[model samples]
Target chain A: MKPIIEISGISKRFRISHELQPYLNIRDRVSQIFSGKKATSTEEFWALKDITFSVEAGESIGIIGKNGAGKSTLLKILSKITPPSSGKIISRGRIASLLEVGTGFHPELTGRENIFLNGSILGMRKNEIQGKFDEIVDFSGVEKFLDTPLKHYSSGMQLRLAFAVAAFLEPEILIIDEVLAVGDAEFQKKCMGKMDEVSKSGRTILFVSHNMGAVSNLCSKAVLLRDGKIAMIDNSSKVVEQYLHDSVQMSGKRRKTISALDKSFTLQLPYWVNNAGEEIPSYSFGSDYKLRFDFEFHRELTFLNIGIAVMNKDGSRIFTSHSVDDKSFQSFSTYNGKMTFDAHLNIPDLAPGYYQVLFGVADEHTHDYVNASSEVEVILDIAETHKIKDGANGILWHTGQWKKVG
Target chain B: MEYEIKPAGRFSLNLSELWEYRELIFFFTWRDIKVKYKQTFFGAAWAVIQPLLLMVVFTVFFARNFTIESGNIPYPVFVFSGLLLWNVFANGLSNAGNSMVANANIIKKIYFPRLIIPISSILSAMVDFLISIIVYFCVLFFYGLQSTIPSILLMLPLSLLITLCTTLGAGSFLAALNVKYRDFRYVIPFLIQVLMFMTPIIYPVSTPDMEWVRTLLLLNPMTGAIDLIRSAVMQVPVNQTAVAMASVSSLLWLIIGISYFRRTEYYFADLA
Candidate 1:
């Protein structure tokens, strides 16, 4: 069977005016020819260069790219919003896209009419649309004001209605481009639920999002678009790992600095089971995250204290852990030896992102700092979008739930 | 097997595809109408007001002492008939010309036929035209104008068809050009003003006995349309020859305009 969406050797060239290019007035236009001056020169910019891909039926594909990566341009071509400058596209079925929510709702038309209007534009038959009308309204959660004109609806309300209509239509192929990132977390979950159902029903989906967590969760396979070309295409786990590595490098990675070893104190990560052993990649959230430290001592006595602070991407500490703070086990009294300190942590409550962590070893009296480290990228892949079927829990991992018996 | 790219870009006038999107056309047309009249104190009566004011101005200055040799019809009736056709023509033309540019966001982001933009703009003007027709009916009754029953009925659709043809031709033509040239906007309204008189809107084509002059005026398609409308309202016999002339000419212009529009429309998302 032929793939539902086939893109072959496609490319697009756009002629863009250079801002700094000098302009010639109409009177000067003729003078340039006689004066031997170049007039109206252009620069050809390839927005998408020689790209090809295909999606089989019932497949969910994620497209990830940085800015100017041609992710959106590729989707626009697939949806037939714009034609490619070269090559051909053979698509087997109707395509419904929600590049932006509530795209063409007339402010004057009531929510009810706009629904039908949007439905028809997405290529649903009138009678066919009428049957799903109530479901669309209910999913949108804008039923009470269905009779009111759409212009009066808030942006969120409009987005709700728009997304509900698009997702509910069940087109043979669906194209989504970063629109879901606008809605609140709850609505994103709701959309994720619907997308899950749609894919299960054997419709193809091409989703483009910068949010790596959403991509890895919702997509079975993924493509990393870089500089108008397919940089990589692999399973969600592999692609996400590569994407996060790229994200880590882009967010201004660690700068070269003098190690504070000559000072009274220093903090360094303890390497335990790194396969290559140079520096283990930072652990992700929800995984059994382990932070190991090589605790060193030059001259130490008794009652020594040390604490580990895990700060979010912005350096706000979610919570801190202390070795001395938790007692009844043991205390530190050492001389000069490198000892491994392993703090195994199951981090569940924190959101998925890059964060900073600092480990400091300090004492009660001398007021001397022993060690410190900063800017480690801990990428946490949130629970996958369709994890409920796999018996996965909610957004935040649960420690326990209470039950009452009367 | 891959074929070489052809520059003779195939015009996709897929009506069935448009039929699938019929609801969007209606919704957008509804959008234009609602936004047009909403919050205005005059309500939908503004439709009647605009043409009535133009009618009064034409009646006062142009009709007061003018005798331009209409086809045996009174001056006010002649001007009013012309105004009726011109109102629809002008309103539809302006609205459709700017519809594509005005809905730039939708045009760029969504996947709908950009052709629907101008077509819906023309459709929205029907509301105003229908309302003003009632006013025209009263004006005809008060003056005791002999309403040509057969001709009026037959020519109403004919006049509308001509108006639609002119609008689609001019509107689509301008809409594509407007994307490329911002300067066309300033030139358009001024051009419309000159076209109003050039089309014999306020006067008949020419004296009945002036053979060359009448023939010259017949070259204008709107001349045929306006003359047909006047002949209908004033209970005159049909001019099949002039209409045959106008229909052929107007249809040619329509084809030329749409073909030019199709050639340029592919670049709109980039240029606009």
Candidate 2:
């Protein structure tokens, strides 16, 4: 089978001007023209360099990259919103891109009118929109406010309406950006389900996202981009693992030490330690992890509290732990000397992914907070030898046993 | 199902591609017309109010002060006739000139025939012109002016066609230029202001004292459409030479405007 879209050696270059002003007035332009001054003070920056890729029919390809990795640029070039500075792209079948929701929606227009307006903007014919208008309104659940102007609808409602229009668009190839980042969790799930249905119907999809979980779930193949070039192209899981590994290394060391200027105290951490008190970058799933902190104080300290927070890659806090939360450590005061503090946290059966630990110290009475100089990354790798099947489904592994009562 | 986009060169008019997107053009024009009066208190009345009010002001000031000849026609009707066409040209030109910048969001996100923006703007202006013509007929009735039914029917649409063509020409030129150098925004309204006086909207083209000035006015593309309209609708004698000159110039402006617009439209998404 032939590929539906083929891109070869595509590159985009934008000229960066050093001048303070982004735009010139008519007077300055006229004077410059008369004076014959050349405007050559520009630096060329390539947003994409020789990116080559192709997608077969009915394939869903996920493009994973950090900001400025040319993901959006590649999508824009494919959508024909902007021309590439060099290279060629050959595409078959109708193409529609949803870089943003509500691209042409008018604030003053009623929800009903905006549906048609946005539908046509996405290349839907009038009859096609009319045919599925009721389905769209039903999916959006904005039936009560259909006649009201879009400005009166809440942002969530507006987003649902916009998504409905794009969802109903039956193009052969659909290009989507990070539009799923909006709305609540339930709505995101619904959007993901809708995209899954579309892909199941044998449509070509090019999805760009920062959410590794969504990309892994929806895409069979993934392309990782770094520094405007293809870093790796492989199965979704392997690409995501490589991307996570590369990101961890890019941040350099995980352990750090900080000494107070007044010599009041010094905090040091050797590394992230497992339950066995051994340094490790990764831990087996469903195991307790420990972090040991050594502190030295020249002056006596009172009412010192230690805190730790575990966060996911997207900076969402998984949970927080503090010494104050424990009954024995409350109201504890330390003398002027060396002391060791240890935090033991049981890792919930978390899905196999990277997590980070944040440490901070504070006075309970004064509420004066001191941040840790560095954070540690905890990689919860699925145990290779254990072979626990179907356990690592969601963020937490709920251990509810199933019984064949019938 | 298949499309190719390459860097645009000197002149390429994708007329077939434009035709394929005819529905979008219709939607854009309809949206503009609907949104124009959507929340307004006066609704469509504002369309007629503009040219009607301008005619009253010009008739009060110019007819009262100067001994202007209107070919034995009433000054109010004469000026209104001229204002009718002028309103279309001026409104259409200004609307089309700013349409690209106004629809910058859509232009940046979607790929369509960029010419649709300016064309739809002109189409909306034509709607306003059509509304104002009804008032033109009432004014003709009030003044008790008699014109040959056949000639009025024939000349009305022809004059409107010429005005529409001229507006499209100048409007697209300014629209394309405005995307790069927004100075055209300030320049358009001022140009229209000076052009109103130059095109014999308030004064007759054939001023008895200044043959040289009359000949110069004849060179203006609008002078021909105005003279043709006056001759056909008001039964004024036609200036054959002026009509020929105006027709030729208007066509020339149309050709040049479209060619220039087609050449530069590809870069609008980047520059705008």
Candidate 3:
């Protein structure tokens, strides 16, 4: 089978101008020419370099990397929204890209009108849009507001309408950026399902996203980019694992410095410690640990809640614990003085990786009393005494009884 | 259809590629026309009202004040015809000049013929031009006059076509420039104002005792078009020299405008 798209040694260079004014007026240009002062300076920034890749006719490939890794540049080149500074790309079929939702949606136009306008802008023919008009409206669930102007629709509704138009596009190749980062959870799930359906239909897809789970689930092949170069390309699961592992080392042990002042109080940065009250680099999953921070109160504060939240690298919260959760510390209060606060914790069965511990103080009633806060990242590793599977299929784990009922 | 994406050549104007995206130009034009009239009190009436009111003003200020030679045509009828074509040129120029910047969002997100943006602006102006044409005919009828020239109807569209060509050329040139140097945004309206006077819109090119000024005004592409419209509709003897000059100049401007636009369009995404 032949590849449907071929990219060879494509590179893009941008000249970063360091002029004080973003744009020049005729007077300034004329005066500068007479004065012979070529005051502007520019530096060359290569956004992509020698990015060679090819996709088979039915393959779904995920391009994953940190921000500024040239994923967007490559997509822009493929979509022909912008030209590459050098090299070339050859494709055998019509390619459409959804770099952003609602690319040409007019605010004053009705939802029904925007559907047609955005569809045409995305390279859909008039009859093609007409044929799918019903499906697109049904999918967006904006039937009642079809004639109402788009400005009145909630932002989420607008996004759904935009995505619905693109979803019905019958292009031979589809490239999508991180359009899934918005909208509600249910809508995101719907979008994911739609993408899954498109991938199964044997068209080519190139997806760029920070959602590792989505990438691993939907894509069979994954490419990792770093500093405008292809860092790795392999099976989706393997590449996802490597990216997760590398990200841990890349952001190693970031610490928040003590803030100078606040109206209510000031708190030192939080840190992880074990039973011995000594700081440790990491704590094994399921082990008892404590995160402690010292605070100096400026005035009497009653009914305060000190809480800590554990979040994954993607910033999704695993769980949260508040000091008030303990029966003994249900009504903790602080007076004008220095005091140390500690929250004891035990991690549940979670995937072994780095997690961020965000600790803050808040007034239980006002919620606005989160007058001071800080966060610290800590590593959670497998327990040395326990044996576990080499590779985990999901983010969580729980012990289940193994006696066979049969 | 297969596509090979590479660096654009210096002067590559791919008409076939433009042909493929022709529908987009229509869609863009529709959107512009819709948006321009939406939420307005007068809607398409504004199109007719604009040239109609301009004709009233010019007829009062210029026709009554000065004895302008307009052949057998009533001064008001002659001025309305000129205003009809001049509005198309002026509106088309300003709209196309700012079109790339106005549609910068679409240009950055999708790929189509960049020329479609300016072309659509010109098309939307044509919509208004058509409305104004209807008003012009009504005015001519009210004046109890009719074109004695048997081929006046045919020549009318021909002259309008020349006007369209000239506007497209000049508009695209300004549009491309506006994308890189947004200061052209300010220059466009001012340029249009100066150009209206330079063209023979309000005053006839055959005004007496101004031979040098008449020659300079005829050099303007629009002067030939407006003069042609007068001669064809008012049954004045056609100035063959002006008609020939306007056609060649319009073509030259079209070539120059589109080629300059083609050379600089690749950077529009970056600069706009």
Provide the fnat value for model 1, as a fraction from 0 to 1. 0.31
Candidate 3 residue lDDT tens string, A1-406? 5689999999999999788677899999999999997758889999999999899898999998866889998998899878898889999988999999999999989999999999999999999999999999999999999999999999889999999998998888999998886676699899999999999999999999877667878899999998888999998878876776665455435544454233676666666678888766556777787777777777777667778777664546689888777887646544567877667776667766655555556665635344222222333333344667765545675555679799
Q: What is the TM-score (0 to 1) of candidate 2?
A: 0.80
Against the true structure, candidate 3 has what lDDT?
Answer: 0.82
The DockQ-derived docking category for candidate 3 is: medium
Collision pairs in model 3: none
Q: After superposition, how far is residue B59 of candidate 3 from its true place, in Å?
A: 1.5
Candidate 1 steric clashes: 8
Q: Ten consecutive residues with minimal summed lDDT in candidate 1 chain A?
A: A374-383
lDDT of 1 at A107: 80
Indicate whether candidate 2 or candidate 3 has the larger TM-score. 3
Residue A30, model 3: lDDT of: 94
- The candidate that wins on lDDT is 3
Predictions in order: lDDT: 0.71, 0.80, 0.82
- Report the C-alpha lDDT of model 2 over A1-406, residue by residue, as the tens digit: 6688888888888887776456888888888899987544778999899889888889999998766789988898888888888888889879999999888899888999999988988899999999999999999999999999898999899999999999998999999998886776689889999999999999999999866667777888889998789999998878877876765554425444566544578877424566677766665666676767778877888767777776655445688888788886546556468887777766666666666556667765634244342222333343433655775566565556889998
Residue-wise lDDT of candidate 1 within A268-382, one digit each (tens)? 4433223333344544444454566655554454655656665543224567777776765377566345556666544656544444444556666633363233123333233
- Evaluated with TM-score, which candidate comes out highest? 3
Native contacts recovered, each model? 0.31, 0.46, 0.81
